[model samples]
Target: MPTPGVDRWTFGVAPLAQTVELAARLRRVTGLALSLEHAAPELDALLDALAEAERRLAPLASADPAPRVGAAVDGDGRVYLDHSRHIGAFNPGFPEYEIVVDGDQATGTVNFPVAYEGPPGLVHGGFLALFFDAAIQHHNCDAGVAGKTAGLELRYRRPTPVLTDLRFVLTRSLDGGRIRSTGELLAGDVRLCEARMDAVQGDRARLPPVSPRREQPGPV
Candidate 1:
């Protein structure tokens, strides 16, 4: 069985925050590299050199790293401001978006870059769902409803455009520890997609919590 309270994919908050910035820069590099993949063959040498450098650094980078902690987690086990997989933060796998909450509603605005394209000049359908899911989760969190995503449904009304600013809005209501939420993605006034999410709020005691370490141990 897997060890309790351990998520290898997640990192310590401080280190992850620094890595999040690095990931953002790496994301830009990725976009440029993809754009240039079809260009002159001479660039292959440069890409090869870059890849070799990364290969050499990978092992040293992760060797004996500090243990991961739950610093960004709350008393109720909610992870906030975790930039790695928390799409709400500045992680580049998901569109970088900002949210503003007013009462039970949360509105977000983001721009899809060319890297997120599926069809020519259109945002990928899967990314659209991710955008809505993150937005709805943010809404639930801001409304003081701590929960996990139980189920989600999305409708693609039209192809979402890439390389343009888009807006997303979500709202949630709690009923018997379950949050029923809905959201919409819009390009200007045109609705591109809509989504519904079911989140189940449970007691924190059900989880095995990990506390943050304040001091690092000496190397053996």
Candidate 2:
């Protein structure tokens, strides 16, 4: 019997088997050829609704002034920053760093503080890169793959304020055994940054294999 709560439309006995079954089922149900170029209104609507809900409830639900999850670690590493909660906030003045990982895509937001300013009240460029890198890396992680920053290209169109809402989106993952991702940072309707990044599968040797070693080296 199929596992409870597992949708026949999305999964099967085996994960790979489920993909094939889902594809066939989709074709039969929609009567449309499946391709990246195709867009489904229903699916789009659902995704939009989810994003909207996330945005609306972010402030209230994430107002807890505590660190629930740490930074991205290979096998569970923990790191904290003051703005961590602000980045993943489910409530106002909170962090919305929590990502919605879906296959090859991931999306999240962050609300910076005045302390993050570089020029007057604008966010620093280095900080923007950090946010972009983390979001992209998290995308890969959510896909069951961990990737390293092989290369990153960023363009700053406008200055991002320290105390403002920033929306991030990651997309366009290529095959080639390596994951290639792109992201964007937006403040309201204005685009602040555009970034493209390449990440390879998480390998121990490539990403400092040991987590505890780095976490605590015991006094050199």
Question: Of the candidates shown, which would achieve the greatest TM-score relative to the real structure?
Answer: 1
| Runs off by more than 4 Å, candidate 1 | 1-17, 37-53, 60-90, 211-220
Residue-wise C-alpha lDDT for candidate 1, range 1-220, written one tens digit per residue: 1132341123224335765786677667766776774776657776798799899977544343433334423332322333223463456777677787675687878887777889998989988888777777655555554468899999999898887888888877778889898898898899989999998875545543444533445799
Q: Where's the lowest-lDDT run of ten residues in candidate 2?
A: 7-16
Give residue 186's lDDT in candidate 1 (0 to 100).
Answer: 91
* Candidate 2 error regions (>4 Å): 1-96, 203-220
Which residue pairs does candidate 1 place in steric collision? none
C-alpha lDDT (0 to 100) for residue 117 of candidate 2: 55
Cα lDDT, all candidates: 0.68, 0.57
